[model samples]
Target: MSNVIFTSSATAKNGRDGHVKSDDGLIDLKLVNPANNQVAKGSNPEQLFAAAYSACFDGALNLVASQQHKKIDSETNAEVSFCKDPEDDGFKIAVTLNIEIQGVNPEDAQQLAEDAHQACPYSKATRGNIDVKLNPKAV
Candidate 1:
């Protein structure tokens, strides 16, 4: 890490059915696996990842548009899925980012989304490690 911008940390107790709290005390919640048929009192890892990825991708979209000297209104929704890995008999995750960009044509919106994906930190981190699908639409 060059010239560290900022770092955030959190602690998780127990695997899927425990508690998690952030160092800033902003996130303190119970964890529950939605697949276990339990009422979710807090949230699962997938939800957290989705939240982070969506926000990051949206920011990346704006940044890319700004660099191109274009103004665009964009929304990014990340769908993270936990699935069984057929290759390893383990579990893996995948992501689908549905992006909506206003004030641009469909092709341009998609180009913006693709450019954003190339710029997003989350997308860079998950590249080649997980399957990511991008769906961009103009609205």
Candidate 2:
């Protein structure tokens, strides 16, 4: 079996501004200098995390649904909140999944959501336990 590998490289300049090189090429992200933000011109860590979480959860849900023979339409959306831990001086993230899966029952959606939460790579990789709540819309 052939495996497809994805690689991305990023370099930070002037503290926060950096360029990320992917399969396509270089993309720039410059911080606002004294803005106390990690992303100068593009987006900060929180934004990036949100994007990843949303996409990953969606992909995982798709896989679960397909495996379960659950038919679904519509899309998946996630909102991630990043906050500092008062005791550890670290950060934590909470993700809320808003899933629109037409033609699928709420019970099936809940099961799939749980499976997706366990399967998503982003959920696996985070240092702190990622909290996920699923909101399934009526089909």
Candidate 3:
């Protein structure tokens, strides 16, 4: 905890059907449950998670490439899915990060992605709790 460099805080009212706002007041949005047949006026938790994960993964990819002394043009798309947990009859989430690196071979790109997955904070946090699949391709 002492080595923490940054922290983010947000408050959510109600369960998936109220409002969420960051401490900085930069993100204030209405929340909706996509499975409830509700018209989404703002955003959902899955969408928010996807955005955060994709951005974080992209940054991790850049850091890995820089460490390897390789110039990479990369894009990361995170797809987060909320589904029923068959084992416990509860709910669980899964992520698939579709990554593309320009001017790199498929194998190299995949390797970079694997390395980045080990480096990304999000990936590390969800390593054993949730399933994450990495799909990297050269573009």
Candidate 4:
């Protein structure tokens, strides 16, 4: 196992429609409710989670490409949806990762995405916990 190289902490006042800020002060934003998922409005936990996951997955993709001696230039976006869980009245989340890769064919892009998902920390955490869909669109 690898040792922890970094750590981050954040606190939220209200569950959905409050405020959250990291200890480092780098991220300070108001949390909004997920009723509409409006990008222009204040962000919610789902959006923050999506941002972190996408960045991590993109880094993993780049690392995979380097490890495989393959060149890849890509943009990845994660769309997270909040839904009610079937098991209970509580809520759950689903994810769809849309990857746009430049200078690669569709097959190669898909392979790279799959490899990244296998290696990404976010994917590993959500593997059995939630639904994640991977879509690779090459350009």
Ten residues in sequence with the least summed lDDT for candidate 1: 33-42
Q: Estimate each model's TM-score.
A: 0.96, 0.72, 0.96, 0.92
Model 3 — TM-score against the truth? 0.96
Reference-based TM-score, model 2: 0.72
Q: Which model is ahead, 3 or 4, in terms of lDDT?
A: 3
For candidate 4, what is the lDDT?
A: 0.91
Summarize candidate 3's per-residue lDDT along 21-134 as a digit string, tens digits.
Answer: 999999999998888956657688999999999999999999999999889999999999999999999999999999999968888899999999999999998999999999
lDDT, candidate 4, residue 47?
Answer: 90
After superposition of all CA atoms, the RMSD between model 1 and the true structure is: 0.9
lDDT of candidate 4 over 1-139, digit per residue (tens): 5799988999999878789999999888987785855554688888999999999999999999899888889899999999999899899999999999887889989999999999999999889999999999889
- Give me the runs in candidate 3 sitting further than 4 Å from their true place: none
**How high is the CA lDDT of each candidate model?**
0.93, 0.68, 0.93, 0.91
Runs in model 4 lying further than 4 Å from the true structure: 36-40
**Pairs with backbone N, CA or C atoms under 3 Å apart (clashes), candidate 2:** 30-40, 30-41, 31-40, 32-40
Instruction: Please write out the lDDT profile of model 1 over residues 1-139, one tens digit for every residue.
Output: 5799899999999978988899999999889988794665779999999999999999999999999988889899999999999999999999999999998899899899999999999999999999999999999
lDDT of 1: 0.93
Which pairs in model 4 have colliding backbones? none
Model 4 Cα RMSD, Å?
2.2
> For residues 1-139, could you state the per-residue lDDT of candidate 2 as single tens digits?
3475865666555543553433444445544422465434565555565767788878888888888887776577877777677769997767777877777777877777778777887767752666667787746
